[model samples]
Target: MSKKSKSFFSHFTIAHKITMMYGGIFSLSLLIISFFVLVNVTVIEQNNIKAEMKKTVENIDDYIKNGGELSQETLEALLENKYIEVNVVDVKNHKVYKNSVGKLPSFVRQIQSQPPHGFLDEERNNRSEELEKKGFKVDIAKEFNMDDKAYFISSRDGKEFVLLEKEINFEESCYLVQAFKMLQKNDYYFRSFGLRLFLIDILGIFLSFLIGRYISRKMLKPVEEIQQTAERISIEDLSQRIDTSGPDDEMKELAETFNSMISRLENSFQKQNQFISDASHELRTPISVIQGYANLINRWGKSDPTVLEESIQSILAETEHMSQLIKKLLFLAKSDQNRIPVQKEQFCLNELVKEVVKEMEITTETKRNIIIKEQKTVEIYADSSMIKQLLWIHCENALKYTKQNDSITFHIYEQCEYGCVDVQDNGAGMNEEDVTRIFDRFYRADKSRNKEIPGTGLGLSIAKWIAESNDGKISVESELEKGTIFHNAFPLKKKKNQKYS
Candidate 1:
């Protein structure tokens, strides 16, 4: 096709394309059927004409055999209004005995001049030849001529006719009888049939095009709605969803999927907003403390030794807190972006847990008793440093909440195909609601006492990420004012002949 044709078609919608496809296919099919019908009808009409011509020839032959005289009046009376013409000839005299017309067409004379192509019954012709050689005579010729057609379409009057010839033997004389019948009625019938079929095809194509357009639009309605709904949605307004009220089909599924996407986006945006608010609040407190310490140091640091020393210590503490907070924030940001790379290796959980317990014990040296309740030889594949950091976080958390004379117990065992670590503290435990959200970043239990807690709330959140990055799980159980138990389980993926005490 040309570029112009392609451009033209590209402008058409899917509905229009469907309509045109249906209309073109149906119209082509109709034309093919009509063509076959025309051929069949023409053949049937030809057969009918042949049968009628046979009967008329037989009638004239019978009349001659019955000794009835032939006349123009008799011929007209017999074949009136039938569009039939007859002619009788005397073969011996070479003269016209009877004719429907006073003068014959020049074409008719040309046809009569040639002998008929009767070649029927070779033995009869042989017999006639034998008699002629024995001084007897016979007039045997073909019943049809060489130039005859099944249908003779005459150009003189643009009419269709069938021509037939027969030889009659009457009282030892031969007579030639010719019959002609025009097919004007059959022609008229075909013309009328073609017109009706064309009209019907036009109506059928129009209806098909209309029906195709309607169905295409109906099917694509949901897609249009999806586009419209999407156009109205933005990061600021992700709550808008496409309505999915229809049959359980692909369109409905698409709409449902679109709505689900929007819902996820909305949830993520909400979390992002909350994170920003909480981060701002947490950073603002340390900033205010540092600013106050700087103002105090600037006013009295050079003049008074005690005031200068106090301000330096206070400033150092605030700076350390802010540094820890910022580090935790950066760690979480990298984890969220999947930029934290973990180096995994086989490590002894029992040995690692014992080391963390000993280190934390030496660092605190508190009145609280940190006890190792149980130990097991369980090997797992994970980043040893990450696991150590995780254990440290949990131990530090346990130390923070537990008071003097309270016991912080540690346990290591294999449970359900996992190497497990459990840290139980007899400290200020939280309620069930706090336990549920304990791992959320920046979430601290007992907001009333949060100011007294001397640590950032990102420890447990970081611990959770470390465990999950190593394909492990963490869970916590706490009861208000009773205690909290933190559990870590890693899949026992490797085993070897190694021991640790």
Candidate 2:
């Protein structure tokens, strides 16, 4: 087939394809049934005709046995009652007796003169040779016989007859031949039945095609709706969703899955737009500050030592802040893209927590008291640097929120086969709503805290990412105006062949 033909077939709608398939199946089924029915009916009628002819032959044989002479009246009465004709032929091929109702055809009369004992075999061989001479092939293995009688079917002037012959012991050597006309009424009935069946088959195929089309349309309605919904959806408006209110079938499941996909795409688009806006806003302020300080130094800072020093320090601080923000953003982007590589090793949770607390105490400017409440040697499998960064972020947040005289405590312990660390602070705590969203990127609970404390809001988000990447969990418990506790938990590593001293 050509490509154009294939393309044309492919372009057919589902309903059209289903209709064609159903029509073909229905038509084939009808054809097989009709063919079998016709063949079976014809076989039954032929058997009935042959059986009746056999009975007539038997009756004639009994008459000759009883020494009753077959007269014209007897033959006429037999014809009226049984629709049979009889003929008697002698060995010399002479007609001894025949019914007055009808005369035997010439072909049947000629066959009747043959002897009865091996008559069937002889006739079959002779017919085969005759057909072969006329350039027609014949299967000599195929022979026709009924009981002990030799029979042949013949058609004369468009009328069909079954001729059967049986030998009887008469005073003279004679054979009884019976002829039964193939019933014209049966032919008429078959023709009428065939016409009706053809009409019914045609009607059935039409109805089945229509029903198939309807079912296909109903099945594909959901797909059509999905296509329309997709056509209306755009990047700017991804809020369009498929309706899934129906029975729990494949179509309903498909619609639900499509709706879920649309929801994910919408969330991704919103986040992308929000990230771009936030990044621009954060960078704009730092760039403006750096430019302002540069202008100040250019104008008068060279001659004035105090102005020069202040401007230089301010520019460096702003530049450093921008650099740190960019680095955090890049780290978050890598983490989001699942590109952050982690190198995990066995580390002591107790010593790591103590080290972080000591370092915070030395570096923090506030006069807050920081201490380790509980410590135990607990080994964990995790990325050590990421764990240290998580602890530092928690301690830094504690210091930023607490007052000068407030106390912050670090606790290290083992719980439920997990190495655990808790950073508790007596600081200005947050409410339930703030605690829920505290780890969202760039979300500050106290907006003024971003200004009062020189820090970025991405610290907690990055801390949460680090903890999760190391197969750890970070949870927070805080009450309004009360202290807050941040818990970091990692699965403990079991040591084999080595015991902790």
Pairs in clash, predicted candidate 1: 118-142
Q: Which candidate is the best by TM-score?
A: 1
lDDT by residue for model 2 over 1-501, one digit each (tens)? 899988988999877887788777877887799878876877777677766666667777777677776665655554423556666554434455666356655544444354566454465436535534544333322133444444343343455555565656577545545454544445778898888888888898788788878888888889898999999999978989888887889999999999999999899889878877887788898899989989999999999999999998999999998998898888888887789887778898888888887788788776988778665678988888889988988988998888998989888888886799899998999989999999988888877656867776788999999988777899999986788999999868633543431
Error of 1 at 268 (Å): 0.6
Q: Whole-model Cα lDDT per candidate?
A: 0.75, 0.75
Candidate 1's clash total is 1
Write down the TM-score for model 1: 0.68
Worst 10 residues of 1 by lDDT: 142-151
TM-score of each: 0.68, 0.67
